[model samples]
Target: MKLPTDHSFFSSIRRLLHTYNLPTAYQLLESPPSKEVWKTKLNSAVDQHTVATWQEDIQEKPSLKYINTDALSVGKTHHLYTYVRPNRIDMLTAETKAKLLTGTYTLLANRAVFNQYAVNEPS
Candidate 1:
């Protein structure tokens, strides 16, 4: 569950998507890479595109937002990456806030988003 800060965040995002059996990272790309493309390099470009695209995508979907380690409390973000945002922190029930403190809430909440973007393409 740790993200390597030295590399682009999308590399970690792509890894998490696979580890969680989530969606294809290609959806974040303007033009998906070909089979012959070197993934490490292509992913660097995709990372930039993803952040920009996600920022735009959420503009029209106010109910949803992208949450990343940078937005979390320092203690909670050392090993985190992007996930779908939950309800406002101030409005969370005590029990729900507890889950966020424990990281369980993020894991569970992100599943719905993962499924929403999931692809059936063979690997």
Candidate 2:
């Protein structure tokens, strides 16, 4: 099945980055998560009560900054666009990571839509 918003390729890349490994900052902060804990978190994050979980997860860390959305002006045209605001060194606590992982999985379940957006790379 394909994924929504993106594809397995990006998801795998994220998994590699977030997974408990020698390269992650999490390992430096705490002991590596056990397989059970990882699976449990993944499952819990995607459960029916996801929004609440996401809120809690997001609140876990001291927010560096809130995501901002600004209207982009095309100078030459009247067209404007809303873009995802970025943050520097955004740290995802264990909760956010689980939410992300689960959210991606949920979106990916929609294979047709997932295929449609998977190749839309950001410029």
Candidate 3:
């Protein structure tokens, strides 16, 4: 999904950087980069944080010999494909989904609408 260049969006990223104790990254928020650049940086930070936490949690738990690491990798890939990217069938709201199904919503129009909807969507 394209990152929204709205103030609230940047503010949330600033808070996330602070929460992660990533002072260097937090500093970048003071003079934010271009939207594309910022999005890349943010994605990198999030991915690193996710992997770090997951590794830590796994280390704390008992090892499961039957667990297939390859399967776990595939599951993570599936999750990213299903939820992280935009324009997915399941990510659309009911109203939008209906419009799409009825051929009222074109991809071109939906891109703009979906980006706005995604930005304003509640956590």
Candidate 4:
């Protein structure tokens, strides 16, 4: 009985939402002589963005503090843009913390945010 071996279906499909790392030599790869400099510069910029994002991810806080990295980096970010306050804060006044947490998450998780971060560069 030669059983079919394609068991990893869901895992492969899930990869669509994952971002893959770009190689270091992407800019230097062989290309047509036309627009070489422009292409190289753009590639370098994109790579730099990726590197910054990677650094931010490595430094992400373990606690529930919210940090925004969109302006800071593009590649390394784990799709955590927008307001990310604590789920529940006991130290602060209830009214203030609740107000801070209420529509902030909703505003952050709007349709646009979902489109932007639902897909992420999975490590």
Candidate 5:
């Protein structure tokens, strides 16, 4: 599947950056990701409610940023497969980290689409 590069898509990326308070700065990795890898990551982010989990992973290890979407722009969906450097999460203060985490949790929890599609929620 080709990647989407429409306004709605970029809008989501922009929102992701804003919510994380991440800078627009990023560096692409040496190699582009393969289809399987891109699909897995994208599926994890959009389908599995794993964006927060991925962000946590990135925050825990700066190196992981290279594989995450730190450098976003308007273009083919394949751009998402490009490894980009993220903000130095390791440098964030504890309070700041907590706030970011909370923001992500809130966003995921409140997403209407997520609620509509999510299953196995605890009563």
Candidate 6:
């Protein structure tokens, strides 16, 4: 939801993996699942490296460990970030096309900030 405009390679990869695993914000509100459910879903959707990265970036961070209930409503106005290659545009399903037309999804093309300071900064 509220698709991040950061289109850098690593940021895109992270978003893709997170979306593949986690439920949408709306889904979380409809059925507030436990952390274990989230973890299981994450593990099922990604490789070991991704999972380990999640552990280090999110799970290990005190601020990010708990769900932020306030942010769940963001999905109502914005769809998840989706990247489609130019050549693969024709491969999208009818439903996906409809969503895109309806402005439920965003196609971000902006460059992400990726300086060394940002990468090396401690959380």
Using Cα atoms with residue i matched to residue i, what is each candidate's TM-score against the true structure?
A: 0.25, 0.20, 0.39, 0.24, 0.21, 0.24
Q: Which structure among the candidates has the greatest lDDT?
A: 3
41-111 per-residue lDDT for model 2 (tens digits): 55554442444444565567556125221322222332111221244323334335555644543444565
Structural RMSD, model 4: 18.1
Query: For candidate 1, what's the RMSD?
Result: 20.1
Could you tell which candidate, 1 or 4, scores higher by TM-score? 1
lDDT of model 5, residue 23: 34
Candidate topping TM-score: 3
| For model 2, the run of ten residues with the poorest summed lDDT | 72-81
Segments in model 2 whose C-alpha atoms lie over 4 Å from true places: 1-30, 48-123
Worst 10 residues of 6 by lDDT: 109-118
lDDT, residue 49, candidate 6? 51
Task: Return the clash pairs for model 5, or none.
Answer: 3-77
| C-alpha local distance difference test of each model | 0.57, 0.46, 0.60, 0.49, 0.52, 0.56
Candidate 4 lDDT (Cα, 0 to 1):
0.49
Ranking 2 against 6 by lDDT, winner: 6
How high a TM-score does candidate 4 get? 0.24
Q: Rank order by lDDT, top first?
A: 3, 1, 6, 5, 4, 2
Query: How large an RMSD does model 6 have?
Result: 20.1
Give the Cα error of residue 98 in candidate 6, in Å: 49
Error of 5 at 108 (Å): 38
Question: Model 4 over residues 1-123: C-alpha lDDT tens digits?
Answer: 654454655444333223333323333356423577656655666677677666667588554234444445443432332344555543244545455554443443364566745645459
Q: How displaced is residue 49 in candidate 1, in Å?
A: 2.5
Which regions in candidate 3 have their CA more than 4 angstroms from the true location?
Answer: 1-15, 21-26, 63-76, 79-123
**lDDT of model 2, residue 8:** 59
lDDT of 1 by residue, 24-90 (tens): 6776465665655646555655565566556676666755455552453422433323342465654
User: Where is model 1 poorest over a 10-residue stretch in terms of lDDT?
Assistant: 75-84
Please provide, for model 6 over 83-123, each residue's C-alpha lDDT reduced to its tens digit, 9 standing for 90 to 100. Answer: 43445554365457766765665444211243334344358
* Clashing residue pairs in candidate 3 (N, C-alpha, C atoms within 3 angstroms): none
Runs in model 1 deviating more than 4 A are 1-37, 65-123
